[model samples]
Target: MRVSSLLRFRSTSLQTSIAKQQQYVPQHKPAVQDDIKRLEDFLISKPNILVLSGAGISTESGIPDYRSEGVGLYARTNHKPIQHLEFVKSSSVRKRYWARNFVGWPNFSSTQPNATHHALARFEREMRVQAVVTQNVDRLHTKAGSRNIVELHGSGYVVKCLSCEYRIDRHEFQTILATLNPAFKDAPDMIRPDGDVEIPVDYIENFHIPECPECGGNLKPEIVFFGDCVPRPRLDKIAEMVYNSDGLLVLGSSLLVFSGYRMVLQMKDLKLPVAIVNIGDTRADHLADIKISAKCGDVIPKLFDFRKTNPL
Candidate 1:
């Protein structure tokens, strides 16, 4: 699927008022015990499992995913994430993005790692999972104490100067942004994935975005925006992670994006055991040795519940 279509922007005219928009409450099919048992058995058979996680893993933390059945960001709203090229080429787009992000950052940045993240961390500590490659930019795995992690999409917690390579903590950048546009106190219509939100255009007309302190150039989040390629160096690192693993376990991702989907293909090519735990069908579902359609939170913690007395 083309990235542009995946994140197609909803025109301003089509946007409904927040009060008029139907609120999306997340729901999932009840997890089957049989599937959970199968996943546990799969994990037991493979000592060095590589975990590939996605946005669904973070949804239980109160963040939203992009493609969950009825509660995903795309399903809830007409808006989609910003296109990287548009952000880089248009000052107006940057202003609007920063404005909306500024409104949503407090909640997004404060989101904590949930049960699924903690369970994954425990699996890593026990040596059951060798590495975690996450498509999420939220950095919840780091917060959950997973030592070895590869953020397939770069983090949302860092900002970089596009022209000068200068970097700043996202918190510090938020402060700078706040100081620059003190009058932008407009409340957000809704919070989207990656700290983005839907805000009125009027709120953006006078919004002031800060430039790089060093080179007076553009400041952008460190995340790989929609329609952008993951840096080659990062890709190489992930490739090495895949090469070193004996098993592949997907957590909470639809694998709609090629980057994550390619890893599953690699696992198949290597003839490694592959399992997936997601709420819906994934692009690589047919190839998965075992596919469980359920929430990661409901399923991941149970893996450890069965092992609590036994210990891995």
Candidate 2:
């Protein structure tokens, strides 16, 4: 079956299974303001904090995250992301990947930073936040004017030549793609969490992929794919930042991916205080000194006392 058809079938099967299963609704309890206070106190105590963020931070800006309770990509569908090996090994895989990216890039690039991003930027300015290491490839932190940032997963806005190491702006490449694949200029409007959209298998078959203008080599987005490893230099920089900071603050991440979760383990080894602010349960809840189960947009703005009265 085609990739899109397979995904749709899986989604149908999942929904049918869920509908047939007996659901148990959990009891709702009123939220405690003390949790917020504790988070505030934790931030106040740590003069230099290293913030590790994830996709959850960008959800407020209308970008879908990967692992939220009812809204994440996994929760909604069974479509898996492209692995590094597949992408590098097969031309057909490259065509399909770029085709989806071609359809999704417009909306993905146009997304603006939300309140959570602004709040983090403000914290950086106040010297409370030393640096931010984010698992997201959206570049929202940079857009929000946060200077010290480490993009654990590289940005989607950059395209690099696999052979010559030449890089070009993603937007520029998008124009090239449109010119080459005029037939695919009007692809479906379904955008995925990772800036990829769903395209029919027929569209994938006819999609024209462009080669690097410099070396006529394969071009790929400079992101860490599922089967790819994070660069050692980036890991070393993050470790240095964590070591220099007084404590670690996790914002909107479940810590499911070991790349971000390993930081929590390192902090535990160092005996540094760790504070987590996320909507759902995280893998490192037990290691956190303070866990605030709330939306980052709702709680992050309240953590700091700004002069602007209308700050939200």
Candidate 3:
């Protein structure tokens, strides 16, 4: 199906689901004190907890998520991101991808970490958190002072040569792009969460793409695109962290992707307690020992504050 058709279908399906829920479901309720206490107790019991975060965590910092109801990228547009195979095989695809990225880079790069990120960093500093494994490519965790982190998807701040070991900083590459395509330097500011923007095909066709200066190779972002595999070494490292940690605490993720969902499944296999903090239903909701439907920014700071006042 065409991208537009797919998006329209999804939008219609989502609208129908929302209408049905409005008719059948009761009004939303605020988080209860008992739920907060349960989460706090879980944290106190497991100091060496591994945190699994996803796009929802970064939404508070002004980056849009891919799957949030009525506000996600899927619900808002029909732009399908470049697939890994298409990028490797087609120069036309590469040209269009880089063009959109050029326009979106500034705003995407300027986003700062929010309260949830800072609270997680504090947890790491206090030795209460074992490590953080995130599915986001924005590097907000690193920016927030999180020392121990495993980025499930690689960072978007670096670009690598396909045929050589050469790497270039994305910001520096942006300067090169501006130099190559001066006409596009002043392009309208439209940014996406994945560092891509909407650009007309005619404009994209005129955009100049750069090759690896060091080896004349194709350049691509360091992110793990769809249809690409996460490096086995990274997976092994995350598995080790899960094995060593006392329990798992998921923050702001729906766990729709199998990669992030697998961690929750691993915790279940080990019979370790799992607690989730998200605004909606997650894939592992049934498996979680404690599930609190709330925003991570609101819940995490309160959790840390609760810990300070009532130390276990």
**Which candidate number would show the highest TM-score if scored against the true structure?**
1
- 1-312 per-residue lDDT for model 1 (tens digits): 676765554433334422122223256688899988899989988878999999878877767777766777777777688999999999999988888788888888887888889999999988898999999999999999999999998999999989987999999988888788767654644554433466667778888887788999999999999999999998999888888989899998889999999999988888887899987789998999999988787788989575566887
Query: lDDT of all the models against the reference?
Result: 0.83, 0.82, 0.84
- Model 1 ranges with Cα > 4 A deviation: 1-26, 186-198, 306-312
lDDT by residue (tens digit), candidate 2, 190-259: 5543433677788899988878888899999999999899999999988888888889999889899999
State the local distance difference test value for candidate 2.
Answer: 0.82
Clashing residue pairs in candidate 3 (N, C-alpha, C atoms within 3 angstroms): none
TM-score for each candidate, following the candidate numbering: 0.87, 0.85, 0.86
Worst 10 residues of 2 by lDDT: 20-29
- For residue 46, give model 1's deviation from the true position in Å: 0.9
lDDT string, candidate 3, 1-312, tens digits: 999999999999978744532331122356677787788788888999999998888877767777777656676677675699999999899998999888988878988888889989989998889999999989999999999999998899999998999998999999999999888855765554343376777888998888888999999999999889899999999999999999999998899888999999888888898999888899999999889997776678777585678889
lDDT of 3 at 98: 91
What's the residue-level lDDT of 145 in candidate 3?
98
Q: Enumerate clash totals for all models, in the order shown.
A: 0, 0, 0
Model 2, residue 61: distance off in Å is 1.0
